[model samples]
Target: MDNPSLFEQLGGERELRTIIDEFVDRVFDDVMIGFFFQRASRERLKAKEYEFAAEHLGGPVTYSGRPIAQAHAAHPIMGGQFMRRLRILEEVLEAHDVSPAVREHWLAHTEGLRAMVTRDSGGRCDPVDAMKRVQERGKE
Candidate 1:
C-alpha cells in the first residue's frame, strides 16, 4: 500500500479538528498572547486553522483565508508572543499524543510562517529580551 498522507497519519479530519479546537482554545486563553486574539472570532480562527493544517497535511482541503501576512498585518506581534503561541501548539500536540513525525512537521511548518506573521525573529529571543524589543519597537 502507498504511504498514508500526514492527514491520514493524524487520523484524518475529525482528529485534526479535535486537536485544532483545543489548540485554538488554549491560544484564546493564553495570558502571553491572548490579547492579540481578543477582538477576533474564535470560531473563525478554528475554521481557518483547520483549513490551513488540513491542506498542509495533504488532506482534501484548501485554505481560503487571507494570506498570512495580510491577515496579521494589523497585529504588532512580538517575538515573545509568537514563541508563546508556538509553545502552546507544542504542548497541545503533546497532550493529544501526536506522533513525533507529525509534531516535527507541524512545528517546522509553523516556524516557516513566522516571518509572514511577524517581523520578529523569534527563536533566539528570551522572554525579557523579546519584551524589551516589543517595547522598543513600539516607540519607533
Candidate 2:
C-alpha cells in the first residue's frame, strides 16, 4: 500500500487550518518578527500560509501566493530573524502536539527556504533546488 501523504498525516484541511491559524497569529504578533508583518493583511497572510502549507504537505491545494523569493525580497531579513521565526514555528508545533515526522519535515522544508527568504545562506542555500524539492514534496 502506498504511504499516507503528509497532508493526511497532518489530519487533513480542517486540522491543518486550525494549526495554521494559530501559527499565523503567533507569527504576526511575535515581538521579534511582528514588525515585518505590520503592513500585511492578517487575513490574506493566513490564507496564503494555509495554501502554502497545504500544498507542501501533499493536500490537493495550490499556493497562489507569489514565489517565495519574490514575496520576501522587499524585506531585509537577517539570519537571526530567520532563526527566530523557526523557533516560533517550533514552539507552535510543539504546542499543537504535531506528530514527530510531520514536524521534522515541515521544519526542514522551511529551513530549506532560508536562502529564498534571507541573505545569510552560509553558502549552502540553493533557492532553485529548494523550490524544486518543495514542488516535489507531496508527490513523494
Candidate 3:
C-alpha cells in the first residue's frame, strides 16, 4: 500500500491544532516576528493555519486563506523575519518529536512560500528596535 499522507502520519487535525497553538504562542512571544501577528485573532489564525498546513500536507482539507502575496501585501516583512518564524515552526516540530523525514517534508513545504513571505525584503531596519512600525496610529 502507498504510504500514509503526511497529514495522516503527523496525526491529522488534532496534532495540527496542537502544533498551530504552540506555534502561535511562540510567535507572539518572539521579538523578531511577533509584531506582524500582534493584532491577529488566535482563533482565526489557528483556523487558517490548520487549513493551510492540512492542505499542504495532503490532507482532505482546503485552505480558504488569501493567496500568499495578497495575505502579506504591504507588510514590512523581511527574509530574516521570515526565517525567524520558520525557526519557531521548526522548533515546534522538534518539540513534538516529528521524525526527520516528516520534518524535512514539512520544512520543504515551508520553503516553497519564501518568495511570498519575503517579497518586502531588502529594506534597512532599526538596530535599536529591529521591528517595523507599520501599525497606524488608530489601527489599535
Candidate 4:
C-alpha cells in the first residue's frame, strides 16, 4: 500500500480539529501566551485553528484570514513568549496522544512560520533565538 498522507496519518479533518481544539485550549490557559489570544473570539479562533490544522495536515487550505505574519504583526515582543507558546503547544499535542510522527511533522511545519510571524508581529525577536530557547528548556 502507498504511504498514507499526513492528513490520513492525522485521521483527517475531524481528528485534526480535535487536536487543534485541545491544543488551543491549552494555549488559552497558559499565562505566558494567553494574552496573545485573549481578544480573539472563541468560535472564530476555533474555526481558524481547524483550518490551519487542515492545511498543515495536507488537507484543503480553507484558512482565509491574513497570513500568519500579518495576523501576528501587532503583537508585542515578549522575550521568550513565542518559544514558550510552542513548548506549550507541543505538550498539548502530547497530552492528546498525537503520534510522534504526526507531532514532529506539525512542529517542523510550524517552525517555518516563526520568522514570518515574529517579523510581522513587529517584534525584533529572532526565530533562531526562540528555537534555541525551546531546545534549552527541553534539556532541563
lDDT of each candidate versus the true structure: 0.90, 0.87, 0.82, 0.76
Q: What residue pairs are clashing in model 1?
A: none
Q: What is the TM-score of each candidate against the true structure?
A: 0.87, 0.84, 0.82, 0.77
Candidate 3 runs further than 4 Å off: 120-140
Task: Give the clashing residue pairs of candidate 2, or none.
Answer: none
1-140 in candidate 1: lDDT tens per residue?
39998999999999999999999999999988898898899999999999999999999999999999999989988766788888999999999899999999999999888888776654445586768889999999
Error of 1 at 23 (Å): 0.4
Report the C-alpha lDDT of model 3 over 13-98, residue by residue, as the tens digit. Answer: 89988998999889888887888887888789888988998998889999999998889876778767777777899999999998
Q: Candidate 4: where are CA atoms >4 Å away? A: 119-140
Better of 2 and 3 by TM-score: 2
The reply for model 2, stretches above 4 Å from the true place, is: 122-140
Residue-level lDDT of model 4, residues 1-140, one tens digit each, is 38877778878878787877877887887787788887888678878878887777778677777888788779863436767677877887788778899899988887767776663342435467778999999999
Q: What is the lDDT of residue 130 in candidate 3?
A: 47
Among all windows of 10 consecutive residues in model 4, the one with the lowest summed lDDT is 118-127
Worst 10 residues of 3 by lDDT: 123-132
Q: Rank the candidates by lDDT, best first.
A: 1, 2, 3, 4
Number of residue pairs clashing in candidate 4, backbone atoms closer than 3 angstroms, sequence gap of 3 or more or interchain? 2
